[model samples]
Target: MKIVATPIQGVYLVETTPFQDERGSFYRAFCDRELDSLLQGETICQVNVSRTEAVGAIRGLHFQYPPHAEMKLIRCLKGRVWDVAVDLRQDSSTFLKCYQAELSADNAYMMVIPQGCAHGFQVLEAGSELLYLHTAYYEPKSEGGIRYSDPKLNISWPLKVTDVSTRDSSHPLLSEDFRGVVL
Candidate 1:
């Protein structure tokens, strides 16, 4: 696996090297030796998967607060998506900055989102699946989000959003007092 850095601190774009043969292809999706420098001492403790059924569906602009902050390594499993990450590290130079990458099964790419960032995705096909490796487990009390359409972030989604969950749509727009998370 080859790791590439993004404009935002601690975010990475990873390309997993795959070997193809007459039958199929084989690749190591994750390797501790190759990624240990980026991972620091964090270990994967949980894995999650999501399947979206509608093209243009939006999933989140979500993250957790400190005590429960998580580092996420996410990849597309079945289809394509416009995956996004927004940096919210309070003391960082790129606070509130957004970064995007196209992830699909064919691409074999993963996005590594650090603890103080919000993550979301827009489905580009009728059926899309994603796999997530998380450094921290879910904690409901630490859950937080910003509206996907928040004017402050102004995310230019690749497609016209066709569906969104009530919970996601209801996330408040970033307020003036918003100071970002301290990881």
Candidate 2:
């Protein structure tokens, strides 16, 4: 796997080298040694999967607060999606900056989002499945998110959002009163 740093610190776009043959193809999606080198000593503690059924479906802009913050290695397992990460680390050079990439089974690529970033995705095709290896387990009380269409962030989603969870729709916009810092 080759890791390329994004505009945001600690976030990366990882491209995997796939070996293909007439039978099919295979690639190493994750390796302890490789990730260890990239993350120093950070340990991945949980793995999660999300499956979306329709195009234009959106989820997240989500993150966990300090003490429960998670670093995520995210990839699309089936179909496609426009994956995005927003820097929320206060004092970071790229605070509030966003990075986006097309992730699909065909590309065999993954994105690494550090603890101080919020992550989200828009389904580019029906039946999209996403897999995430996280450095921390879910902590409901620590959960927080910004609205997908927050004017301050001005995320330019590729598609018109057709569906979103009520929770996501009800998320507060990023503002001075918000406790979480936008990295």
Candidate 3:
């Protein structure tokens, strides 16, 4: 596994090398040893998977606030997606900036999203599936989000967004006075 840093402070791109032969292909999807430093003392507390059937469905721009903030490692399992992470750390230099990567089964790539950042994805292929490893469990009271079409962020989604959950669409746009989340 190779980890590369993005402009966002704690976000990263992880590349896993897959071995292929006549039998098929095999890849080390996760290695605790390889990610020890990046994870600090945090262990994955929850694992989740989602399959989106539409070609351009969007799922999020979600995060947890303060005490419940979680770090996520996301990978594509069956198809392709345009994964994105936006820095929301109030004290970080890159706050509000976003980094996107194309994650697909063939690429064996994953995106590491740290606490105080919002995560979301747009499906690039039909039936795209994603596996997520989270450092914290879901906490309804701490859940937070920013609108996918927030004018302040102007996220340049690669595909024409064809679907967005009503919950996501209802998230309020960032206001000028919004100070962002504090870790």
Candidate 4:
């Protein structure tokens, strides 16, 4: 695993080298020692798998506040997506800035999103599946979100958004007084 830092503090892009042969290929998706430097004492407490059936589906720009904030390592298992992370750390230099990467089975890459960052993805192909390793468990009361089309974010999604849940669509746009999350 090759971990590269992103402009946003604590965020990383992980690349996995696959060993290929006639019988397909193999690669280590996660290695505790390899990521020890980044994870510190944090251990993955939850694993999530999501399969989106339609292209142009938008999932988030979501995070948990304070005590429930999570660190997520996301990888594409099938098809492709345009993954996005927005820095929401109030004290960080890159606060409100966004980073993007193309994640797909073919790329064998993952995006490591730290606590205080809002994460979301736009499906680039039909039937896209994603695997996620999260450092914190889900807490509905701590859930928070920003609208996918929030003017303050200025996210450049690659495709026309075709689907979004009512919950996501209902997330309020960032206001002028927004101060970001304190990690």
Q: Candidate 2's residue-wise lDDT over 1-183, tens digit each? A: 898888888889999978999999999989979877667788889998999998999999899987888889999999999999988887787888899999999999999999889999999999999999998889999897988888878888999999999999999888776544543
What are the per-residue Cα lDDT tens digits for candidate 4 across 1-183? 999998888889999988999999899999989999989899999999999998999999899998999999999999999999999999899999999999999889999999999999999999999999999999999999999999988999999999999999999999999998987
- The CA-based lDDT of model 1 is what? 0.93
User: How do the residues 75-183 of candidate 1 rate in per-residue lDDT, one tens digit apiece?
Assistant: 9989999999999899899999999999999899999999999999999987899999999999999999989999988888999999999999999999999998987
Q: Rate the local accuracy (lDDT) of all candidates.
A: 0.93, 0.89, 0.93, 0.95
lDDT per residue as tens, model 3, 1-183: 999989888999999989999998999988889999889999998999999999888999999997999999999999999999999999899989999999999999999999999999999999999999999999999999999888778888989999999999999999889898988
Better structure of 2 and 3 per TM-score:
3
Per-candidate TM-scores read 0.98, 0.95, 0.98, 0.98
Q: How far does residue 151 in candidate 1 sit from its true spot (Å)?
A: 0.9
TM-score of 2: 0.95
Question: Would you give me the overall lDDT of model 4?
Answer: 0.95
Clashing pairs in 4: none
Instruction: Indicate the worst ten consecutive residues by lDDT in candidate 4.
Output: 2-11
Counted clashes in each candidate structure:
0, 6, 0, 0
> Alpha carbon lDDT of residue 58, candidate 3?
95
The candidate scoring highest on lDDT is 4
Worst 10 residues of 2 by lDDT: 174-183
